[model samples]
Target: MEQKKRKSSATIASIETEYVRSLQKKASRKHARKIRLYRRLTVFAVVAAIILVGMTQMYMKQKQVLEAKELEKMEKTAQLEEVQQEQEALNRQLIKLDDDDYIAKLARKDYFLSENNEIIFSIPENKKKTDKKDNGKE
Candidate 1:
C-alpha cells in the first residue's frame, strides 16, 4: 500500500513538471513572436523615414532649379533691354539712309562708283597679321 501511494504521488509530480515545461515553452514562443513583430515595425519605420528624407531633398533640388530658371529669365530681360537700345540706334541709322550725302558715301564705299572727273586711289591694308599665331609647330 505504501509503495502504491508513493508511485501515485511520483506520477502526479512528473505530470505537473511536464505541464510547467509546456507552459514555459508556450510563453517563450509568445515572447519570440513579439520580438519579431517589433523588428518588422522597426524596419518599416526606418524605410518610411528614409523615403521622407529623399522626398524632401528632391523638393529642395527642384526649388533650386526653379530659382535658377527665374534668375536666368531676369538676366535675359536685362539683355533684351540692351538689345532694344541697340535696335533704337539702328533705327536712327536707317532713317538717315535717305540723306543724299549718306547715299553718296555708301555708293562710293560699297559700289566703288565716283564722279566722272574724280581720281580714285585705292590702298588696301595687309591682312597677314590677322592669321598669325605663336605655335612653334605650325
Candidate 2:
C-alpha cells in the first residue's frame, strides 16, 4: 500500500505589551545588580587575600629577627659569665698581693731570697709534673 503525507505550516508571534516590557526591564535591572554584587565581592576577596599574605610574611620576618636576637643574647650572657669569672680571679690575685706573707713567700720562691743566716737548698724536682698538678688545682 502507498500513502501520501501532508505537511501543515503554523507560525507563532511574540506578545508585545506595556506590562511585559516593564517586567523585562525590571528583570534586566535585577540581573545587572546581581552581576555588580558578584564583582564587588570578588574584588574584596582579592584585597583581603593580599593583606593576609602580607601580614603573614611580616610575622615570619619578625619571628626570624626575634630568634636571632635571642641567640645573640645567649652569646652575650655566656661572655658576661666568662668576664665575671676572670674579674673574680683578678680580685683574688689583688687580695693576695696585698698580704705581706704571701708577697714574701712569692718573692722568696721566685727570687731564691734567704733569711739572715739561713741557707737555701736547691732540690731538683720534676717541674713539669708539679706545674701541671698545681695548674689543675688552681
Candidate 3:
C-alpha cells in the first residue's frame, strides 16, 4: 500500500508539471500575437497622421489660389464698368451730334452760309480778338 501511494503521487506531480508548461506556452503565444498587432496599429496611426497633414496643406494652397482668382475677377469687373461708362458718354455725344439745330450751328460757324442772299456785316463791337490757332483751323 505504501509503494502504490508513492507511485500515484509521482504520477500526479508529473501531470501537474505538464499542464503548467502547456498553459505557459499558450500564454506566451497570445502575448506575442498582441505585440505584433500593437506594432501594426502604430504604423497605421503614423501613416494616417502624415496623410492628414499633407491634405490640409493642399487645401490651404488651393484656397489661396481661388481667392486670388476671385480678386482678379473683381478687378476685371471694375474695368468693365469703367469702359461701359465711357461708351455711354460717347453715345450721349453722338446723340447731340444728331440734333439738327446743333449740326446747323456747327455748319454755319465752320462754313459761311446765309438763309437769304444777304451781305455779310462785321460789327466791331461784337467781334472779339482771336487767333487762327485758337479757332482750331491750324
Candidate 4:
C-alpha cells in the first residue's frame, strides 16, 4: 500500500531578540568572509597557472631558436671548409702554372707543339688503347 503525505498549512514564528539578531549577523559575515577568501584563492591559482604556461612557452621557443641557430652555424662551417679547400687547390694550381717547364709540358701535350730537333710522333688512338691493354695483360 502507498501512503500520500499531506503538507501542513501552518506558519511558525521565530524569536526576534537582539542576541539572536547579532548571532545571525555574525554567521552571515563569516559566510561572506569564507566566500571572499575562496574567490581570492581561485583568482591567485588562475594567475599562477597562466604565468607558468607563459614561461614554459617562452622556454620552448627559445630552445627551438637555439637549435636552429646551431644547425645553421654547422652548415655554414661546412661550407667554409669546402671553400677553403677549393682555394687551397686553386693556389697550388696557380703555383704550378707559374713554372715554365710545367707550362711548356702542358702546351706540348695539349697543342701538339714540339721543341727544336725533337720530332713529334702522332700515335693513333686505337694503337694507344691496344698498347694499354697489352701492358695490363703483362
Global lDDT of each candidate = 0.88, 0.89, 0.85, 0.93
Candidate 2 per-residue lDDT over residues 1-138, each given as its tens digit: 122222222244446999989999999999999999999999999999999999999999999999999999999999999999999999999999999999988878888997788888776578877988999999
Ranking by lDDT: 4, 2, 1, 3
Q: Please report the candidate that would top lDDT against the real structure.
A: 4
Q: Best candidate per TM-score, number? A: 2
**Residue pairs whose backbone atoms clash in candidate 4:** none
Cα lDDT tens digits for candidate 3, 44-70: 999999999999999999999999999
Residue-pair clashes, model 2: 0
Model 4 C-alpha lDDT per residue in residues 33-66, reported as the tens digit of each score: 9999999999999999999999999999999999
Q: How do the residues 22-131 of candidate 1 rate in per-residue lDDT, one tens digit apiece?
A: 99899999999999999999999999999999999999999999999999999999999999999999999898896989989998987788988987776554433443
lDDT computed for candidate 2: 0.89
Candidate 4 has its poorest 10 consecutive residues by lDDT at 1-10
Task: Give the candidates in order of TM-score, highest first.
Answer: 2, 4, 3, 1
Better of 1 and 3 by lDDT: 1
Residue runs of model 3 more than 4 Å from their true location after superposition = 1-16, 104-138
